[model samples]
Target chain A: MGAEREPERGAERVVVGDKRKLRLATASLAGCFGCHMSLLDIDERLFELVERVDFDRSPLTDIKHCGACDIGLIEGGICNAENVHVLREFRSHCKVLIAVGACAVNGGLPAQRNHLDLGQCLQEIYLTAPDIVGGKIPNDPELPLPLDKVHPIHEIVRIDYFIPGCPPSGDAIWKFLTDLLDGRTPRLGHPLLHFD
Target chain B: MTQPSILLDGLPVPFVDGQTIMDAAMAADIFIPHLCHHPEFKPQGSCKLCTVKANGRYVSACTLPARDGMEVENNSPDLNDKRRTLLQMLFVEGNHFCPSCEKSGNCMLQALAYELEMLSPHFDQFYPNRAVDASHPEVLLDFNRCILCELCVRASRDVDRKSVFSLSGRGIDKHLIVNAESGRLADTDFSWADKAAHVCPVGVILKKRSGFAVPIGKRRYDVEPIGMQVERLAARSADEES
Candidate 1:
């Protein structure tokens, strides 16, 4: 918490003594969680990453919401009102927002339903499916209402960076993060930019 | 007479007098990203991914013929940004669920998008509802994935000589239609072994009952990027000709 202050003029001199770790927040909106799993695929490097960055509010720390942070890594598409809210919150709170994986970047598999009528989709899933014993399209006031169509996060918010893949490879993620931390624009080329 | 040469990104590429910029580049083992220009068929500059700047003017490499001293610019940031936008339009225009599609790895459209490093669709999803034609006994025509490159149309007319496929409609409504009164592949003389069936660059024309036989990671573009394959093939052809 002590390290979360906004830098004042000439704060660079004071920061040499403070030694604040950069804060990172992450969230999954409407994806399969494959991207988050791929992040963990960084494996042993997680130890090194933890030393350089702190989890401000993320699934890694099971934090409910984000605080003022240096970076935000968002996975998944915007499928409902709740996603829109969380995305806007991240934009306001974080200085840099990175849309990670195919879903976050291009609506991925979930956007396949974009061609189908939302009402018919809900009816098929919730009421007409063979496995359902007694099901209804749950319209609880607490639940988020579905958007007419799924959308990539960038269509709704300003995303500073994108890592594209069904689940972007661990190496790509590592390179992007380390490059960002080292003050370089991440360029995905050759083997790094795979779609399947 | 000696062959005329064009400068592609400052590299000299020799071309036959009548060859398009794309054909000359391919013969030189250079890759200009494209979807509609298959070697087996006539060039159709439908997919403009192979757009390159020639002497400060942008033109589709697939259709534009090469001329002596022509200076072509490819693989640049400005051109790639435009290519990325074109790829994005294709993505959102159709429901391209790469993770679930049978042609996930082998699809040229997906591979080109990857090569361009198109991070996001960068546009709203159109999600145009399209139908799948599983009526054919040995082939599946999933219209959802068609990029309208006209490869199948050209292959059927020129190679198979069956005239089994044709494009119908205009603009957003344009689609691949079977060449039959009933408008179904089953009603036509189309077969799985036809050149038209094999010429589809995307998942639109998939062989029935042959899904995922090669496994995910070992698929065509998965093993090597599409550009590398084109370059390798070009090199092999050049070697054979010499």
Candidate 2:
């Protein structure tokens, strides 16, 4: 099937056969690297992917700050002040932002702590545990202060699309990216759309 | 005279005197999505997933009786979007970790979410601090996954005559509880074979030692979506009656 064009979202659509490739960036915060690992599982297709898009800021490039990009893929939820800052910065730099995974979409497993009092949780782990000798809660100014509850990325910034899975499969990621590259609104069918 | 019928999204559905809109639609092989509804149990209109416009008024199909010549809107885009919102509400209300959940594929909540195309929870996560009750040797109760459907409560009380479960608390504090002073399943006379044991639509009630027995790809909703499964079941039942 021919790829369908999507409505523009603050960025120019990538034209196929154009020498200039689309700029793509990715970020992970308060999430396990499972989503990134799945992205790598795109394996051989990564060669084809690089041909269509130039990596701007990602672990693959080790570029800490995101530059102006066409697409930004965010993984994980907002659990700390730093995560909020990073997410906002990414939103400002990228034209289209996609929340990629259960964590970024709905605050995955780490959000299990949302009901517990953050102070009590820290105390229970650091001071009252069985193995404790002279334990105390760490008081470092450099530490990113934890938010009271975990929040999905959309709660912090506008999201153009959402890819919902624990860590969406390698094939799912490939399909989504290729759809964007081809100017189609990414639509994940039964096999691709999964939470687990 | 003639069989009583209702117009379901412009399609006619025949029904008997006492059948609800849900029953009529099911018998006609038209799927009206629902949760907290079982053919064997008394209809509880708590979930609101089966809401439909009955003659221009919204009502829960499971509880609203079908009337002859009544027009009902079942599969409209507006209704489906509302259902998606309800599903999203349920998702964020509980701490649902689908990746690690034992009931992932076979779970009705997950299956219905997929059926309705719910991409994200759409709301802030509550992440309630509920405990798991593993006291029963043959069963497990993960309070984090309960949608407060009360299916187990009805199954235990009406089918098994055991009254082994009940819901306690009000509003947001509402939750399922075992029928024992100790608040443990092992302290009660509950059995794995009880009807309530297997009635849970979510991961709240899980059978011990049987998790992952069926691989991920082989589970109930893996090959077919829940809508098709419901329709297929309806067709089979209609065939049996004929």
Candidate 3:
């Protein structure tokens, strides 16, 4: 509402003035870096995103562990305390919270480890996989956090949108951003978003 | 697609809604060359070979939504040139060793390439160093022959919701990555019963032991092509579901 006007042609986009530039932020928890990398998939179009929205605390651009903003894009699953705190803060601050990849949307890849007991998976990956880190973190704790089960972002807070994909394709990301910034509801595009 | 549509080289053709101009032309006995757009999978416009002139713009008939008064040209001289170039793009991009391929007799890509009379790939080979992960207890992978139409990715991710497969890398470096870590599908939770091994449009992904079970020159699809395979598969799917 900050002096943003109707788009010159479409119902959205400001024709003039400060353009009510939406304050935005993004973060990740415990999934593959693939989701964040998908943002880079935009190649050159990412410049348009920088111009349209203000990224206040993205892991890529910002140093602050957390911040208040309008749009919070959380990529990765919740398997630790840091994930919980960051997710809650984003939920409280952002006007719209988007679970921005498959892991965030429906407990993607990391959750694949759910098939076995947490202890067993830890022992298998560390003690069993070809190369063992062997208490690599030393005093540091392992994932699965013992007694608690891994959960998706929606389980912890209300999510306004879900952009699914192992990592969603760049075109899907572009469409969603265009739709949201333009105040139009977005439909999930490309069957990949629905894919694992 | 409501009326008997426009010319296919001056021949009158019929069309129906919820179908493409290619379908309409095919119904009127006109032939068009396309590699990736089997009537089975969702209309992937990746190949752009099935592209036809609709109201003077080059649009892929397989994926375009038809409208009234749309003038479609299926076999104009310019369109044939466009299609031949697109087919050549596919032909040169991958290792389509037709002499050694199993689906040679029934493959849509090979059949279309032959129909276009393409004798040699016009460009340099990509020669991607992809390892064949025949790791699935039931399925096989020959990464050399993959065209990345994403049919297997869709069938697994969308239909089965298994997400057992994915595409890694991008552009020229892009290739299929299955399961998770080992890149071995059997290491993940894929089962023999999953239909992903059945619907792959190319010979890249195959049903391992099931290969040649139907025998050469006698496979059910040898004479019928994919349109009928889809119809029969749909019926089989419904029967299995019930």
Candidate 4:
């Protein structure tokens, strides 16, 4: 090895002379769309971001399938079979993968059900909870099978970075993205590192 | 008699006759990073967050009495790494749910994690089935967030003289329980004015209807790191004694 540094796995080198824009994708699994809302909170700065980045397989683009991309931000936990499939596919498509928000990082609010029996939880909601008449648990092959427990994305696939907030502030996301673009190790310190 | 001292992270820290390593460290405005070793209460050394190497042996700094020439490694990388693991273990052991928690920014456990730069929970969450005791009209005891530090137990017994709280069961099954036969907070004499009512380092014991009185970003730990805040408090106490 000479003076040159090898790029880390999932970290694509952005050469100064390269003219191609970076491809970015995002996916939501078992979470509220709050993380994406925070991403949109980037607001007008997103217009400036598109000048250097391209969106693929994201709610922003309304694309159902993820294509090969430079970075992928996955929100929410793995709570169902579909989430697992989507996460694995997303991981394969992106060079860099980030677990965004508390859900992606540590299974957030959805994980409150982790201690409960999934079957019992379903039963309580549909059959027993309150005023209910002839409630039945839906069992359709078209519906995604729910997992026994909600798990953070890293428990299922490798995650390059973690933004640890319920929904990380848009400014924090912007700082992390700009740091990555500038070839610096992304660090969320002080106010930005909040979990809530 | 000459005051004994310990070399804490290569820095000389003086201690009086009966003060522990934590006492000396706090007196010197040095942070040892602890959860259960509150200055107001007697040190329990239960959490083990303040584990430090004293003369080549690991000991809880909060409980161990300082000796002259004792070389302690407090902030070593290995120790901090261990501390990070401890923080992660604590996070996964409980249903922290910081976003939904009223104690988010004011919580000591969350603040300590941020101070230690804990990025993820790092292990599969245990997420043990727990309950919230909202029977008390003035207080709420969410058993989900307890780290089993027993600060509340000590505070209730020693300070408030209520003995309203105790840890029951054993091993993985160990849990906090109320003193009343009915097993509810409302059945006990725990008032909002009690020391035990306010000693929780996490979000377990909370005031009813007082959630989110302070905005998210404006709370105690959000403004600055825990180390700075603890040190400032220590310095303020030292100034008061003089």
TM-score of chain A of each: 0.88, 0.90, 0.79, 0.90
State the TM-score for model 2. 0.88
Task: Give lDDT tens digits, candidate 1, residues B1-242.
Answer: 77799999999999988899999988888889988888756787879899999999999998999999999998899999999899989988887878778888777888888787777777887777877888989888889888998888988999889999889998888988999998889998888777777767778988788787777667766778877877543211111213
The candidate scoring highest on lDDT is 4
- What TM-scores do the predictions have? 0.90, 0.88, 0.47, 0.88
Clash pairs, model 2 backbone: none
Q: Best candidate, TM-score-wise?
A: 1
- Give lDDT: candidate 3, residue B130: 62
Docking class of 4: medium
Candidate 2 CAPRI level: medium
User: Candidate 4, residues A1-196: lDDT per residue as tens digits?
Assistant: 4335465422444552266889999999998989999999999999878877899999999999999999999999999999999999999999999999999999988887787899998999899988978999989999999999999999999999998887899999998998997789999889889898
Estimate candidate 3's alpha-carbon lDDT, on a 0 to 1 scale: 0.65
lDDT of 3 by residue, B45-68 (tens): 877887888887888887886564
Ranking of candidates on DockQ, top first: 4, 1, 2, 3
As for lDDT, the candidate ahead, 1 or 3, is 1
Candidate 2 vs candidate 3: the DockQ winner is 2
lDDT assessment of candidate 1: 0.85
lDDT for B196 in candidate 3 is 62
- Evaluate all candidate structures by whole-model CA lDDT and list the values in order: 0.85, 0.87, 0.65, 0.88
